[model samples]
Structure formats: C-alpha cells, structure tokens
Target: MNANMRAAAPTEVLRYTAFSADPDGGNPAGVVLDASALDDAARLAVAAEVGYSETAFLTPAPQGTEGAPEGRAFTTRYFSPLAEVAFCGHATIATAVALGERIGPGELLFLTPAGPIPVTVVGGDGESGPRATLSSVEPHSEPVEDKDLTEALAALGWARGDLDPEIPPRIAFGGNDHLVLAVTSRERLGALDYDFERLKELMLRLGLTTLQLVWRESAGVFHVRDPFPVGGVREDPATGAAAAAFGGYARELGIVPEESRFTLHQGEDMGRPGELTVDLRAGDPRVHVSGTAARIG
Candidate 1:
C-alpha cells in the first residue's frame, strides 16, 4: 500500500435508498460526502464494506472547471464492490438527496467518468423528502450483434421466441451501456434465474454493466429488472443508469413518441418495489430520470 492509502482518514458514509420514498423500497447506496483524504484503494474498500451494489465518492472539482460553480460542483466517482463503473444512477440520486439535506435543494453538477451530469433536487423539507432528477448525457442506441444476443439469451435461460418483437434487442447508452431485452410476459421477467459466472463473463467482454430485462405493461408503463452480476450483485433492485439508457432506447426505436414520459417499476420481484420516471423531449436527445430517495439507517 502507498503512504496515502496507509494514512487515509476515516470518512463518514451516509446510507440512502434511491428511487423510492421508503428506505426499504429503493436501491441502497453509500455516499461519501468528502473523499478528499482517500485514495482509489481506500474508496473501493469503503464501498466493499458498505456492500451496496454501488457507492458514490465526491471530491472537490478543480478551480475554474466549466459547468462547475463554486460550492456545488464536484468530481464524483462510482464504485461497485468489484470495480469502478463509468456512471451510476441510483448512487447519483442518493448523493444528491444527501447533499440536498445538508445544503438545500437545487442544482448540482457532477463530473463523472462518463460525462458531466446535471442533477436537480426539489422538495427536501416535504413529507416525501427530496426528489432528484438527473439529466443524462446525450444517449444513443445500436443494434446488438446476433451472436452476442444469442449468447445473452442462453445465459439467461431464455428462448428467442420469448422476446417481445416490438422492441428489438439493442445496446443502449445514456451513462453506461445496457443490453435492453423486452420479454413477452411478466412471469418470464419474474423468474430470474441465470448463470451468474457465464453472464458476468459476457458482460465484462461486451463492456456491459447490466442486462435491462423488461416487460411492457402498457404504452407508458413497464416493469423492469436488471441482472448486474458484473457489479458483484446478482440483481440491482432499482437501476437508474439502466432506466436512463432504456429511455433513450425507446425514443430511438420509435417504441414511444419522440416526446413522452414513461414509468418503470423495478425491484418488485425482490420485494423492494421502486418507481422510476423517464422523460424524453421532442428536440432533446438526453433522457431525464426522476425519483425520490430516503435516508436509511
């Protein structure tokens, strides 16, 4: 270990659940408000200790960095138990709400490895607590290769005929890459059994963070689940990043109107139900994901 790693100061890690008002409903995330004294190794250690799917570490941004106003801009990094990811939606929302409690709700800028993310927090003092809306970077989707899709289905123990033909398989990118797969029935979606090692290998090989397993309930309502073996977690209760990527995928594929809003209900199968709201504007390519978070002891 290096000198900095050895002498790392203890930091306070705040626990909060994102995408739901109830702490027990959403995805739990660890937030390190000030990670200035910790190095990369120390940060990862904290995340592993917290044992959530992901954690957010915030350090002060460099002076005069664009879009980073004083006292509100931060260079944030997301780390899973196994590795550092480019971006994490739930952690970002959790961190924003945590900051909102301390600094009041409004706009905050986070410089992430993926890109600059703009987050807005509102109604912190209300009965529901703070709700955060994160505007993702420009998003795009592309068709997945035949071989890769076949391999994914096999690892998932799903047949090709089980897929929803309306939404073709595609790799979508908002903050990170997720393979979007829409199923024909909610029963298929709930029966979450997969070969963890095999799926993790495929995800790591394809630079995928999670597989966005979804079942469309209506034109604007959907039930979603994410298999996140790559993050050392079998499933992510509520995945903000995947939700944002799915929004882009829906818009790009014309599954929904150019300007539309949709609801994604996740974590129900895990007994931790959470709701995510995704909005797409007519002229804007970026997707907006909004949800409420609550502090967890």
Candidate 2:
C-alpha cells in the first residue's frame, strides 16, 4: 500500500440527510466524527466511496480556541468526490446533526477553512430529529464581470433577457463564492440544461463553487436551484452556503428589508425536496441558515 493509504486509519462515517426530516429527501452527506488520523487522500477516497456530493471530516479543536466552548469545538474540512472545498453548507448541517445525536443537542463551534462557524442544535424530540442552525461568517457581494456573466449564460444556454433585471447578477460569498442569477420565471428556472464542461471551466476561472439559480415565488419565499459542476456534482439538492450568500446578496441590494426572514425551497426539481430558512438581523452582517436533518438508515 502507498504511504498515504497506510497512514489512513479506519474511522466511522455517519450518513445523514440535511435540510429535510425525511431520509429520502434533503441532501445526503457523509460525516466523519474523528478524522484526525486521515490525510487528504484518505478523506477524498472516503468521500468518493460514500458517493455524496460532499462529506465533512471533523477533528477535535485545540482547547480554548476562541469563540468555542470547552468541549464543543471541532476543526472541520469538506471534501467532494473530485476535490476538497473550503466550505459546504449541507455537509456542515449533516455533521452538526450527527454530532447532536451523539452528544445531545446544544451549541457547538466549528473552525472551518473559510472561518469560524457557530452552530446551535436543538430538538430531537418525538418523531422529528435534531435541527441545526449555523451562523455563517460575514457575507458580501460583488458585481459579476460582463464577460464572465456572458460566458456563464452561454454555458447554461440562457439569454440575457431570461434573467431577472431586478435581482441583477452578482458573485456572492458566504463561506464559498457562488454566482447568483435570478431567472425571470419558474419555467425558465426548471429548464436547467447546461453544458457541464463549459460551465465547469467558467466556474473554475471565477473561483465559484455553484451557480445559485433562483425564482422568486413571493415576497419572502423563493424556489432555488444550484448547479455544482465544480464539485463534480450535477446539482445540489439543498445548498446552505448558497442560501447564506443569497441572503447577503438580497440584503446588500435592498431586495429585502434589513431584518427579514425568508424560506428557500430547493431540490424539488430533483425529486428530493428540502427547505432552508435564512434569517437576516438588522445589525449583523452575518447570515443564519437553519434546517432539520435525519439519519439515513
């Protein structure tokens, strides 16, 4: 065996679905409670073996890490079938729920590559499983370059007229960067046929993790879809990172009030429906994404 392979220790990986209480719904993610002995190659291998879009690996954080409670802090990393990403929302939620089941629901801290993420876990009573709320790091948005936007649209086979002029196009950042494009109608949003290689090239050049395609249903509700070619997944059922970034984008552009709560419906087109709740506080620039998760038997 190779040195890297030999260095990997057999660790227990928990499988869970985030953003939905039903196991068949939501996005499935693999969570490793103790990956301290696993190397990058090992982690990648595990993620590929699990066949999920993303998997979270957790190692105990150093004692007294800032903002972390004495026994509830962990250093976390995310890996997809193809590569390691700076952050992943669904995987984070799945990991938190898995931890909650073992340690009892409470406040927990995760030191991720993007930044420190504070998560609160509650419930696990009766039939409903544990729910987790993760507060993202400060979010921001920047205008999408004209050339990049054009290229992106071309990859998706979409015309400029199909875009929602009200929302505009922007590159938003929560934990990872995402290209936000609001479609004019739900029909246009549902017809998501994109050139995989072309979009992947554009995403890599722009340092984007996914394309957050959205269609507003009402003042506080929207249907969202994420094409994650960069992560080697065709689509993400429920994307927490993109939801957080979208909240920031909306607040930054005044599409929503300073303090507002919104619901994001995702994965419906893929048949695995899930819901994500986004909360924007008046004074805090950070976005909070909350959802429920259940173990997949």
Per-candidate TM vs. native?
0.96, 0.96
Candidate 1, 265: how far from true, in Å? Answer: 0.3
What lDDT would candidate 2 get against the real structure?
A: 0.94
Q: Write the per-residue lDDT of candidate 2 for residues 118-218, one digit (tens) a residue.
A: 99999766776888999999999999999999999999999999999999999999999999999989999999999999999999999999999999999
In candidate 1, stretches whose alpha carbon ends up further than 4 angstroms from where it belongs are 1-8
Residue pairs in candidate 1 whose N, alpha carbon or C atoms collide under 3 angstroms: none
Q: Least accurate stretch of 10 residues (summed lDDT) in model 2?
A: 1-10
Q: What would the per-residue lDDT of candidate 1 be over residues 15-133, giving only the tens digit for each residue?
A: 99999999899899999999998889998999999999999999988889887767999999999999999999999999999998999888999999999999999985567799999
Prediction 1 global C-alpha lDDT: 0.94
Residue 76's lDDT in candidate 2:
96
